[model samples]
Target: MTQARITIDRDFTVAEVPRRLFGSFVEHMGRCVYSGIYEPGHPEADARGLRQDVLKLVREMGPTVVRYPGGNFVSGYNWEDGVGPVEDRPVRIDGAWHTIETNAFGLHEFVEWSKEAEVEVMEAINLGTRGVDEARALVEYANHPGGTYWSDLRRKNGAATGTQQDPFGIKLWCLGNELDGPWQIGHKTADEYGRLAQESAKAMKLVDDSIELVAVGSSSRQMPTFGTWEHTVLSHTYEEVDYISMHAYYQEHDGDAASFLAEGVDMDAFIDGVIATIDAVKAAGKHSNQVNISFDEWNVWYQRGLDGEDQPHNVAKAGWREAPRVIEDTYSVTDAVVVGSLLHSLLRHGDRVTIANQAQLVNVIAPIRSEAGGPAWRQASFWPFARMSALAKGQIMQLAVDSGKTPTAKFGDVDAVDATATWDEQTGRLALFLANRSMEEGAEVSVDLRGLSASGVRSAEVLTIPEGGDRNSANVLDAQDTVGLKTLQEVGIEDGVLHVKLPALSWSVLELDVERA
Candidate 1:
């Protein structure tokens, strides 16, 4: 077994656990919308045609905020098409995904669904095909109280029911989705996007200054325009937008599991790069308002398989099918462990990366998977997310881990054991999230809980491939429960030190009742 040590101090904290960090994304892509979240004929669907089983599972996953309408789909979307009665709504070709959008479930329906799932809406506007005027109109339609054309139209359209919160009280907004990517609808050069985002944000805020807007950064860290795109966009929209958006999707290529397992190291580097750019722009422009990150799209997607050889440009060729299956990468224990590591990266950078939405919450590379008219089940990746979101509260303690290094092709040398901890003073609880990246050896970890005593373990669960199984082992539709999370038995505390034996290539969450000494 590889040995590792972690020291966590309450005073050396990163920041309060931003509840929005546990957000998820829902796009109008593939089956994510129609058959995934809304299927009227499905036996388990609610009266509103939403899959109750899916909603139940989503609520269990406990996403605090859900970004909606599109990944690429939002670029070409017209806000008006999705309002009023379902029958009256127009059917249009979703140029982003090359699909026929029925407009059956639009803004009103989404807000209703969000209420049912008990998650906040992180709305994204259309800057690709439309611009500032449309964005401002959207703000007025969703937010303004009454008397105005859009607000009165919102009432006439039947969004007057939920929560009595004026303008639906939707606070977070995305200016657009991945505008830097060539594949994006109305793809913009960095200058084009920055100028557009700035003006759009300015106009939307004019409608309702209470809203927080996110400017689009690079679609992926690997994009050729990554650093320059961020710098240019932030340089222009720094004062106007609250956060900058990032989107990334990772997959194991050419059987590079070792490198794939250490993907979080890359994520950390990506966060660092974006932060550096943000700070540089801030320093040069002499601005005080901190521009944070909204990692609105991050997931493990099998892009090669999903997009054939032409990959990024394949969406245009997918034909005009409504809700065609796309990029639904079934996850394995390995994927789940990597996800846990990514979560560790996010928590470690909690001070700046305040909002993160795991892309496509339901069917497309999501933690929870639902079958139309069938069963909805938890994916292997679901356990860590659900557990962390539930148990990690209060402040993110600054955790330092010392461990042996592992060599990988992509990220060079990374720690065999990656970990993060949260200290919740109100509940008298401390939660530790740990991931072992080693493929062959279990990690013996000793955790130093400075100025805190672990009274007892509240819960400890580990997700690992079962004996005789390897990394490729996954939770399929029929065998969903077979590969889920299992209890971690080898855990104990002694003399203010917590000891845990993490299985090779596993994700573990250990929650303990702690008291200040």
Candidate 2:
């Protein structure tokens, strides 16, 4: 058995847990929109074409904010196409995903759906093919309360139309999505994107000064222009934007499970590097305002697979189809553990990473999967996200984990036992998220609540490959119950210590009624 110990002091804390940290993305790609979230004829769909089954799952996952209408789709999207009567909405060719985009679900539908899902809308503007005028118009249309050109148009379009047609009042906005990448539509150099984002942000803010803006950061840490891109972009729009965007997708390449399991180490490094770059630019520019991170698009995507966008896509060769399946990577227990660890990384760095949306929240690399005209079920990755979003509250408690190391090809020598905790003073709750990366042994883990006393264990659950099940096993469309969280029944506190046994390659969550001494 592998042994590990963690010491957590209630007083030694990170920052308060930002609610937006438990966010998800909804892009107009593949089945994410048409059949995923909006299936008009689905047995459980509402009158508005919103899938009640999917909405139930979404609400259960507890995403606080949702970024809408693009990953690459937004770059070439004309917002005007998605508004007005459903019959009148244009059916256009979406170059981003090589699909026919029937603008059935647009800005108005999204805002309505957001209300049903009980999440704030994090809107992204088009700086790729469009510019400042469109950005300002979007802000005006979504925000302005009364009689004006865009606001009047919004009212005329019958948006929440009745006695009191209200504005969406969306607060958070992204300047663009991944313009730093060569793959992005209307891709721009760091300086070019910086200038466009800055001016657009300026104009948008002029329309509605209350709105918060996020500038475009690099698509990934591995981007050739990563550091320089952030520096140049921040140098230009640091004052204008409240946050900068970051996107990343991880997958196990060549079947290296050990390296794949240590994904949190890479995530931690990526966040730290971004923070360092942000600070460097701040120091050079001598700015007082802090620019936080909106890690808007992130997940374990199998981007090299057939459905991945990395493949050579010929729109002309393959006839454009509506809502064609794309990048819908089915996750396994191994993937789920990595995802839980990644969530720990984000929670550990909660001070800087205020907003994080797991990419393509429905069918495309999402926690909840729904089949067209069928049922919606929780993926293996869903349990951790749902549990963490529910458990983490108040402040993120900094933990001192003393554990042995595990060697891997990608991120060398990561801790065998990794953990993070949250302390909610008002609720008198302490939640611990732990990961055991050892593939061949159970871990005898002890958590030292040195300055605290636990009343009792509220809940303890662990996600691992079930007995007689392989780690690669998944909950596909047919057999949707292959992998899920099982109760960790043998957990207790004795003399200021929490003792629990974690199986190899597992992710666990425990909640306790804890009070500071």
**What residue pairs are clashing in model 2?**
none
lDDT of 2 by residue, 1-517 (tens): 8789999897799999999999999999878998899999889998888999999999999999999887789999999998887788889998887889899888888988998999999999888999999999999988998789999988888643221247889999999899988878999999999999999999999999999998988888899998899999999999999998888888889989899888888889999999999999899999999999999988898766554342325433567888876666789999999899999999999999999999978987888888888899889999889999999999898899888888899878888998999999898999999899989877888999867889899999999988899888788889898998899867988887999999988999999998877
TM-score versus the correct structure, for each prediction: 0.97, 0.97
User: Residue 236 of candidate 2: its Cα lDDT?
Assistant: 95
* Candidate 1 lDDT, 411-491, residue by residue in tens: 888899999999999999999999999999999999988888889889888999887788878878888876777899999
Top candidate (lDDT) = 2
RMSD in angstroms between candidate 2 and the native structure over all alpha carbons: 1.7
TM-score of 2: 0.97
- Please report, in order, the local distance difference test score of every candidate based on alpha carbons: 0.88, 0.89
